[model samples]
Target: MGILEVSNVNKRFGGLQALGNVNLDVAKGTVHAIIGPNGAGKSTLLNVLVGKLVPDTGTVLFNGTSVLGLKPFEINQLGISRVFQTPEIFSDLSVFENMLIPCFAKRDGSFRMHALESIASEKDIIEKAEHMLAEVNMADKRHMTASSLSRGDKRRLEMAMCLVQEPKLLLLDEPTAGMARADTNNTIDLLNQIHDSREITMVIIEHDMHVVFSLAKRITVLAQGTPLVEDTPDNIKGHPKVKEAYLGEAAA
Candidate 1:
């Protein structure tokens, strides 16, 4: 069994079926990409995996335990961390302060921002945050306010926050979105470095084929809220179903 499993999952919104019988198995310690064109239910499926939206049917299992109906923080405590498409950070806070937040995270859906007063005593947490920041090459910017950083740096800071938590499964939602070609490539390289240095499993929902082929060991193509095919990146590149999903029936 994979580290993360989705079995017969379905979700709907009024007249629209956002996800239909979606079943996915993301193997342990592998980068799995979920790709499709707009309105293909990629975002909806991501929401389901992170417990933001409980599906109408089926189950989501993480590390052999059911994650359905759990709160987002609860899921995080269970070794799943998500990096959002738009970098989510405390814009007014220093980069170091933002990194410290997750280090002092409470499992009950709260952050201990007040703990900053006694931070001098929290040497272990401080070291961990510093190490993670350095891993993402943000240690030099640790004192800068998060809002002043460039888009790519902001994304890097956000990634460091998630990594500080040391999650088993990292869910990246369009990790390279809104980046320049150079920034996108740099982000890909950073991700590869992280993957190589850890035993983490990544599930990516991306619109960029370049990003997908660069990092994903397995790729799943979703069309109209259902999976069309799941295969290796090399095979997925020219798969007829993938072409049909993006280019329509004529190309297929």
Candidate 2:
């Protein structure tokens, strides 16, 4: 059994079927990529996994436990973390401060609004945050305002925030979207570092074939809200159906 399993899942919206009997198994500590053309329900599937959307049928299991009805925070507590396509850091806060937020949340179980209590006083939290920043190679920019950082740095900071929680599974939605070539390569390297250092399982949704082939041990192709194919990178590249549905005939 994989660390994360989606078994016969289905979702619908009014007259449209968003996901139809989709099944996926993500092995532990492996980078699994999900790719498809637009309107393929890739984002919808991610929403379901992160607890933003409830499926109409089937179950989502993480590490052999059911995660169907759990809230987002509850799911996080179960060791599943999600990073959105856009960086969701505090623009007004420094990179260090942003990392501290997740550390605090993981420790305290929720956000504390007491402005008088110095966040610096939380020594353990500070250390954890700094360690995560170092893991993502953002330690040098820890004191910089999140808004002042470049786009790639913002994404790195967000990743640091998630990593501080020590999640078992990391869900990434178009992690390299809108990045320049250098930034995309940097993101890939960071992900590689994370995979090597942690036992975290990953499910990545990406449009770039290069990034998918480089990072993923296995790839699943979704088409019209259903799984079209799931195979190794080499098999996916040669798949005629994948070429017909996603990669153009000329490219194949």
Candidate 3:
């Protein structure tokens, strides 16, 4: 069995079926890409995995444990961390301060109502946060305000914030969305670095084929709320159905 297993999952919103019998198995320590056209339920599938939305039917198992009804924080505590399409950072806080929040939450539990407590006094937390920044190559910018960083830097900061908790599974939704070509390539390199240095499994939802092919060892193509194909990057590049359904003739 893979580290993450989704079996015959289904999700519905009112009369709309957002996902139907969607199943995926992500191996440990590999990059898995989920690609689809707009409204093909890619984001919805991510939501189901992260506990933002519960599937109407079927099961989600992480490391052989069920994770269907858990709260978002509960999911995080279970060693699953997610970075949204938009950068979710504390804009007003310094980069170091932003990192400290997740470090504190992971250690002290999710609802520590002690915002007034001085995080600096927690040497272990500070050290862990610094290590996380170093992992993302953002240690030098830790003192800068999070809002002042460039788009790529902000993405790096958010990624570091998630990594501080040492999650077993990292879910990234459109991580390189809206980035310039240079920034997109930088993000891809950062992802490669993370994959190389950690044993974490990553499931990425992206529209950019270049980004998807760069890091994904396995790619799952979704269409009309169902999985159409799952194959290696090389196989997917030449698959006839993938070309007709999603990749298009030009990409074939």
Compared with the true structure, all predictions reach lDDT values of 0.91, 0.90, 0.91
lDDT of 3 by residue, 1-252 (tens): 999999999999999999999999999998999998889999999999989899989999999999999998999989999998989999999999999989988888877787677766889999999888887788899889999999889999999888888889999999999999999998998889888888679999999999999999999999879998999999988677777677565775
Residue 215, candidate 1: C-alpha displacement in angstroms: 0.5
Error of 3 at 195 (Å): 0.4
Give the per-residue lDDT digits (tens) of candidate 1, residues 1-252.
999999999999999999999999999999999999999999999999898999999999998999998999889988899999999999999999999888878322455446346778878878888988887888899999999999999999988898888889999999999889999999999899889998689999999899999999999999999999999999998988889889988999
Query: How accurate locally is residue 219 in candidate 2, as Cα lDDT from 0 to 100?
Result: 96
Q: What ranking of all candidate models by lDDT puts the best one first? A: 1, 3, 2
Per-residue alpha-carbon lDDT of model 2 for 51-144, expressed as tens digits?
A: 9899999999998999998888888888889998998889999898898888888887855577788876889988888888887788899889
Model 3 clashes, total count? 0
User: What's each prediction's TM-score?
Assistant: 0.95, 0.93, 0.93
Best-matching candidate per TM-score: 1
RMSD of each: 1.8, 1.9, 2.0
lDDT of 2 at 122: 85
